[model samples]
Target: MFSMFRPPTLNIFSRSSRQKDSPKTDIIPHLTPNRFPKLIIASASKTKTEFSQQQKQSHLSSVKKATANNVENNKGPKADIPTSRSISTFPKKQLSSSPPIPRSTDVQPFKGLAKSPSTGTFNSVARIDNSSNTNPSVRVNFHLKYQTSYGQSIRIVGSHPDLGGWNLRHALDMHWTNNDVWTATIHLPSSNVVEYKYVLVSYDSKGALSWQSGSNAVLAVGEEDTALDVHDSWGNGPGASVSSEGGVATTREFKLQAWAQDMRSYKEVARSAAWEASRKKDELAAARAQIARLKMELGLGSKERTALEERVAALERANLLLRAELAQGKLVLKRTLEEAIKLLSQDALSVEEGE
Candidate 1:
């Protein structure tokens, strides 16, 4: 019976001796015959501790690999495992413990910029120019009074780019406000000096334009002035005195006279007709009075009565010739006015097309 119990003591002695001989193993206390159950329990605990250590080593290797991958990919820093914690307190728990807490990286990208793939350079963002939206612009208003007949319109040409650069073919048309008034508005750059002129344009004839008879109208715009108004009349300018005796002035004067003739020709014709009628009546009355007196004084002569009849016929013929001349004058005036209007119309159409 003692030999069966002796085998347990012998096994404990062998394990304790083996532990003492290994350099890495801890020295377990020698077991007595009465502590046989304790020896078996301690052996089971050592096996469990070895298994927990292996699991912990595997978890640590995996974490190290993950951290290196994050660094190479520039994914920022990773949380560190707490090696300061005592592993003996809960060796098995370490393998099943919660994951390490993540940490934020200090690396930051620039704002309002983007990287260009081809050039491998950073470019700034685009922004719109705000000065144009905030700054006020210069404006000019033109007001004119000119009488245009049928097929004729008024135009303005100038030396600046905005005003067609003195090209009559690109002249700006004026809006007719009334029978005589015309108006237009143009925008100009600030602090600019501009020269311009007005012209009468014909819609049917080429190269038939009537320019204003004076030097170009000049304007000096100030930077501080945002708006300006100019009032003018056709063929009238500040330098008109210099053109007073020139060919332009003479031609303008002739046109004015023609216009006056067109306006009063009917009245003049009617007046002439009335004057001729009155003169005829007076002549007839005087002839009758003379004939009666001659008959009474001469006591009925055939030659004197015949002479009175001849005088009456001559007076009637003279009156008829005056009426024919008056009709011809009226017809000539009508035709002349029509030609003038057609010439003005052609100039206007050419300018519009060229623009």
Candidate 2:
């Protein structure tokens, strides 16, 4: 029973076995021992090489796509972009070696930064000429030499506006460089004449002043003379060239004026002295007449007579003193006039020679 339940097996290789058992057999070709392994290895290596080549091609394509995208997105002008040649021209060492250049706004020029030279320095120099558009007048230097006592000063007054026009209130004060020398500079018109004089002014009192006892210094300015210097001593006018005839005439006028002034002063003194003496004489005569009347009175006592006599003696002494003083004053006046005349004559002669 169990044998019948078993499954039946068909012979799939029955034909191949019958053929194998038959006397006619198929011829088979023989392969070499090493050829199979070689073939397998070659196939594997070819597959791996193909895979690597595909990966490289894909990577290059992706890079090219990315570069195209960047070029499309950038919108700036082409000229602003730095090129290879411009970059190569700037040396890397020079760029890193030094500081950057300052802009024009940060730098200043030497002309704007230069300083003026200080006074009295070697660089300070005086200009040769003072004439300019702003100042059309000429410069006149006044130099004077004078000896003064204590409490006295020298001043200059003149006919020109620069010299105060003979106005003491506007007189220019002179600067004393030494005990005897005074100097000043004035501006005058280039084509105008100037007449000036030195004066001695008392420091304490303006009223006690003495002018130069001579004619004013006459200076004629021409268009050619832009600068002039006047040198003078005290009581003398400027020592400069002048017309001979004009100088002579001016000198004579000065002498005559001085003489007349001196004569007037002397006359006043003489008149005052004479009037005083005459008054004293009248007083003395009255006293003498009273004494004589007292002596003629018979009732007058010896004591009264003695008193009258004493009074008369006193009057006589006063009269004598007055007479003596009068005589001395006359002599002094005569001598003074003679000396003044002599000095004036000498001055006149000198002025003529100077002219």
On TM-score, the candidate that comes out on top is 2
| Overall lDDT per candidate, in order of appearance | 0.56, 0.56
**Candidate 1 lDDT, 1-355, residue by residue in tens:** 3332223446556766666654321222324346757655554545555645744664555445544454447644443434424322424333443655655655565588544322201111121222443434456667788887888766778875556588766556666776578766666564344568888887554233688865556555444555656676775644221112112322223333344454466457655766776687688778778878888888767886788878878876776776566566556456555544654464466457558
TM-scores for every predicted model: 0.29, 0.30
Q: What does candidate 2's lDDT look like per residue over 15-46, in tens digits?
A: 33445553221121111233535534443545
Instruction: In candidate 2, list every pair of residues with a backbone clash.
Output: none
Judged by whole-model lDDT over C-alpha atoms, candidate 1 comes out at: 0.56
Question: What is the clash count for each candidate, in the order shown?
Answer: 11, 0
Q: Model 1, which residues run further than 4 Å from truth? A: 1-136, 204-208, 239-355
Error of 2 at 210 (Å): 1.0
Where is model 1 poorest over a 10-residue stretch in terms of lDDT? 120-129
* Native RMSD of candidate 1 (Å): 33.2
